[model samples]
Target: MTHVMACIDYSQSSLAVCDYAAWAAQKLGAPLTLLHVLDEEKYPAAADLSGNIGLGSREHLLEELATLDAQRARLALEQGQHTLEKARERTVVSGAAFPELKQRHGHLVESLSELEAEIRLLVIGRVGENSNRGAQSLGSQIEAVVRTIHRPILITASSYRRPEKVMVAFDGSPTAYKTVQMFAASQLCEGLPIHLVMVGADLEDNREALEKARSMLISSGFEVHAEIRQGDVEAALHVYQSEHGIDLLVMGAYGHSRIRQFLVGSTTTTMLRTATMPVLLLR
Candidate 1:
């Protein structure tokens, strides 16, 4: 069976991610896998900085570098294993049954790419352990990972609770319509109240698309609310979410230039970083 995988690092946000993933697994009745990727490129002790090693000292320096590299590799392996163990334990305690743990080496995205087919849903923290800045700045790999993976990714904010009210940011793009179709068919949002909203100047086109989506969702037994909001896309969305007590935000991962200007491209990055609630991005 496909699994719900949670990508965790040795960060403050990792536990939060695990908790969300566990809750998702329990809700979706899917097996859980806790993944921790060890990126060796992030650690570089082999580089020669001195630049002034005599022939006599060159052999010794090379030997020293090799030894250091070996030690670092060993330490990294140990740390990865420990992190996975803790993640598994935490997820299990959070109500996931027999969650699997895996540790992979190399770029995080590459590792995820290899495991993509097996992942039904991906849950990851907004930033990893390496992020020194606070929640305002996303992890270096966040954008790349989200753009590369076609699977629905749940970007965990500082905390998570199973959402009762979810808002979908629809822009009338093929991607947005497909997201509505998927949401209507999937058990992920089965009984939750959904708001299909579009932010634009014209209410006419927005109303048509929202009506179409609302009808489809209603046909599938979902309680759907359709609306058109005006103003800056991100600002309006966050305001609506806060005012309505929206616990989750769903939207397309990418869209055309016009919608991208408002929702998907760089604006998507900003929203993910600043959103107080979790975001589920569909491709």
Candidate 2:
């Protein structure tokens, strides 16, 4: 919880992650750490040889397999190091303070959890290394990371855009209120105008909740545009974004099992998959 951490991989978007992490570090006045994990299952250091072996030649085959696996693991480590170096250089060029480079050999979610206490905010790519160029397909670890890490996560697009106009997708829940408060206090979007949007029936309760959140932001010295849109949640938000040219989308993310299931439904995953702009999710 001392610095901002950005997850980097072999994807081209990893550069954008570095830039975003640098920008966030500048704003929050925290150190920046670039994390690259070499998943053991994906890049094993040694081949499994627990199966029954018959003859002396089986030992030779096992040794060959183990050597090949070790070479693969070494290659993965080298690639990760190169990626981290590039990210660090980019961060320096972006005019932020130098960043700490961290490389691990394990699952991404597990690594993130291990470093959770030292991260104030987590920045990651919308799509993992396996996804295509477009941010249309989500990375495999997106849901798992969302479910495990109880911190602010900024999921970026294929590219980076310095956020100018910020929007918060409010659902009128306690999580939503916490998001507003955290956004206001963090100074992450200190000078940007905020659009507080809720997509649903504009009932009395919704209106009051929206108004309250609006006032809170206003009191924090932000220009607030609060409104309720009708239609599908993702569709409505996209329309509003297109109409106003929102640079970044913000939303509350809860890590509880039930809450995470709901977020996977149409909120976090939908926006991450569809929204072209960077999305900042807070828990």
Candidate 3:
């Protein structure tokens, strides 16, 4: 069975992610693990400053504050455990089996990567409402997790509502083929219509890629439509999605190094920033 790990934080966006994760787990017959990470270091300074009980002299007060910080870290771990329990219950009610709820007290990316050997997919929310306004689009947490985790990540924007129309951004790359294969094998888009779109400066290559992608999808028993568009990739995708009313956008992340994405700017990254539809990013 596919092992899906969902990063949950008890936020509204995280709840939406949980819902999508449950849907995916059910569709793929996969085992789901809801993971919650408590960054104990993030609270170190705050705990030391906030819980100063003034035990006696300056030295005693400092030691008391350090002890209090440790207590606070423990409390955070306990709270995260409780939240994961609730999330697990929600997943079970949503037609998924009781997922393994994991609570780790450490850096989010480190904890997640430690489980990479067991994880096939990672699901995360776009951004929490309480997050900083500027952080909503490609937040630090999302970026960090994506950069570190080699497993495919499904970033959810809102509660997924049975995708009826899925748009595949075909570039003829190996990773893109994997994305196509994933859709072909799963019931996630069983009765849904698929749109194979190839965007590039070269019209001939675009046409060829679209044809190849269409054939692939057709062979998988899907009613497929192909489109070849010119100009900027992000702009083309936005226009196509808007015109065709696409519910989900699928794409592959390609780059040798994280910094190389700066030059090539991954289709997944551009779509995450601009696309109106939810995106399934395959690595």
Candidate 4:
């Protein structure tokens, strides 16, 4: 069975990720691991500019700051633990297995890599509160981990409602096939409606490819639908999703290297930045 890892924080977005991860794990009969990384150095104190204070006084103030930092870290850890426990309880009530909780101290990306061999998939929240700026945005840790992790990553945006209509962007690539196969076996897509969409400038071979993918999904018992469009892949996808109310999008990440992604620009990257729907990116 597949092993799915969810990088969780105390945020509501992370809770949403856990909800989806729990459902996905149950569908695949996979074990789920809820992971939290505690960064002790996330907050830094300013240097004491008041030179009037004696060295002993400065040392005392520094000690107090250190104690406060430790207390805050402990509180955050406790909250994260409680959140995961609640999520596990919910999963158990839903007939899914309770997920294991794992806590590590260090960089989130490095810590996740330590378990890369064991984790088949990673689920993470789309946005988080910025520690330094105090604004909501895509967390740097999540972006870095997604680029670095070799396994497939499923990103949850707001909340976890079971995806009923799933759209796949196929291009006949190995990564695309991997996504198709993964969805075919996943509980997320089992008996769910699927839309197999292929976008290109022309219909040369895309029509045939769409038919092939449609057949595959239909054979698997999905209410399969196909679309072949001519336009920018991202634009066309966004239009289609908005018009049809697509719930989730599955696409292959198309780039051999990071530099290639920059030079040619990937469809996956475009959709990641622009698509409002949740995306499942397969490598």
Task: Choose 1 or 2, whichever is better by lDDT.
Answer: 2
**TM-scores for all candidates?**
0.90, 0.92, 0.85, 0.80
In TM-score terms, candidate 2 sits at 0.92
* Candidate with best TM-score: 2
| Alpha carbon deviation, residue 204, candidate 1 (Å) | 2.9
Candidate 2 segments whose C-alpha is farther than 4 A from its true place = 47-52, 55-57, 132-134, 254-260
Task: Write the number of the candidate with greater TM-score, choosing between 1 and 2.
Answer: 2
Q: Rank the candidates by lDDT, best first.
A: 2, 1, 3, 4
Q: What is candidate 3's lDDT per residue for 181-208, written digit by digit as tens?
A: 8767766677779999877666676577
TM-score, structure 1 vs. true: 0.90
Give candidate 4's error at residue 47 in angstroms.
17
User: What are the per-residue Cα lDDT tens digits for candidate 1 across 6-125?
Assistant: 998888888889888998898889999989887768644455535656766676677687678767877887898898898888888888998888888678999999999999999999
Better of 1 and 3 by TM-score: 1
Instruction: Quote the lDDT for 76 in model 2.
Output: 92
Steric clash pairs (candidate 4): none
Q: Considering summed lDDT, which 10 consecutive residues are worst modelled in model 3? A: 255-264
Candidate that would win on lDDT: 2
